[model samples]
Target: MKYNMLLIIFPLVMVGCSFSTSTESLTDEIITPDIEKIEDVGSEMITHHHMYDNMDRGNHDYVDKTLVIDPNESEIFRGDVVFFINEDGEKDLSRVVALPNETIKISNSQIFINDKKLDTFYGKAHRVGLDKDSYFKMMDKEGNDYDKEVMKKVFDYNLKEKKLAENEYYVISDDWLRGNMKVLNRETVIGKVIGYTK
Candidate 1:
């Protein structure tokens, strides 16, 4: 009986010692955050939005699985992540390009966030007049000289059409090479993308 008791006690003591050693080792080691790893995590999380300007017609949605932003929030702090969905109900990741009362327009082959060309590397390429003029002529409904070449551009503005109120904003895809557009209002917006899948 005593031998069995000692056997059990020996194991208990050994376990206790092992736990102590593990604890000490953990305390002695320093744990640091990896910036590169964090960036990789952010990329996997779909925190940023994406738009295509060159070929794909901007209909392909890259599904993201993080963040849902509220448009009515009184104060939007920095580092807030947001997302936009493709009009075809496809999921693509996008950051909030404009806040409330901001106007997004496409004139040249670039995007103007609040009347200024936003300096961004979010698009694949720049195809001028990809489909802008055709979309304009189609939306005009007045037969305002929609050209045949313009019809080849296959994107229509896919964001929201609702008027932006005092504190509301709008966003658009970067595929408006030829003037075709899709608008995004705050209400229609999906949550801001906080992460993306690889």
Candidate 2:
């Protein structure tokens, strides 16, 4: 029993240690080619990985094709899903919500950064209309009313509008209640998603 226990715990400890020591390695003025190399970001730190079933990073069970983050890459832009360490000292991955010094607001789950409405597809300016097919496809998978449940909403609060510090970034995973968009200091960011494995 003791031996079996050691076998189970050893890998977890190794993974954790490796994650803690991992550093981002990319030169400044990086040029990302199509289909860069990637590795499994690991699943243990994720909460509700199921929410991203259709996306690449959503598959926490194994490596889904994902981009490698390069802290030295320079020019962090809106909509990049960054792999970063969180305040708790655990490694995590979330979508970049806002760049440094940008003021942002959240209304009914729609994010407005610098007074421009931002959409989930890498913080692009949201289109004027909804994509009916997108919602319907989500419904087809989860059953009736699942689409309504997936709608993003954040409670209105006095501090709804916020600006990121110079070394901070905003990231979101599924945009639900608890795991909605958040700001991660520049120190936490490892690299932007560059590409996934084939």
Which tens-of-lDDT digit does each residue in 1-198 have in candidate 1? Answer: 999999999999998887753221101122111111123443223344334322123333232222333433434421233344556776543334455666555433444544444444322123232344545555567666655455443333223223345645444333334322344445555554333333
Cα lDDT, all candidates:
0.40, 0.52
For model 1, give the 10-residue run with minimal summed lDDT: 25-34
Candidate 2 error regions (>4 Å):
1-63, 123-159, 174-180
How would you encode candidate 2's per-residue C-alpha lDDT over 1-198 as one tens digit per residue?
A: 999999999999999988864243212232221234445544322222222322222223113433344555566766555666667876666666677898877654556777666534433211112233454565567675543433421222223888888887777653233343567888767666555544
- Reference-based TM-score of each model: 0.35, 0.52
Clashes per candidate, residues 3 or more apart or on different chains: 31, 12
Cα RMSDs, all models: 24.1, 21.5
Best by TM-score: 2
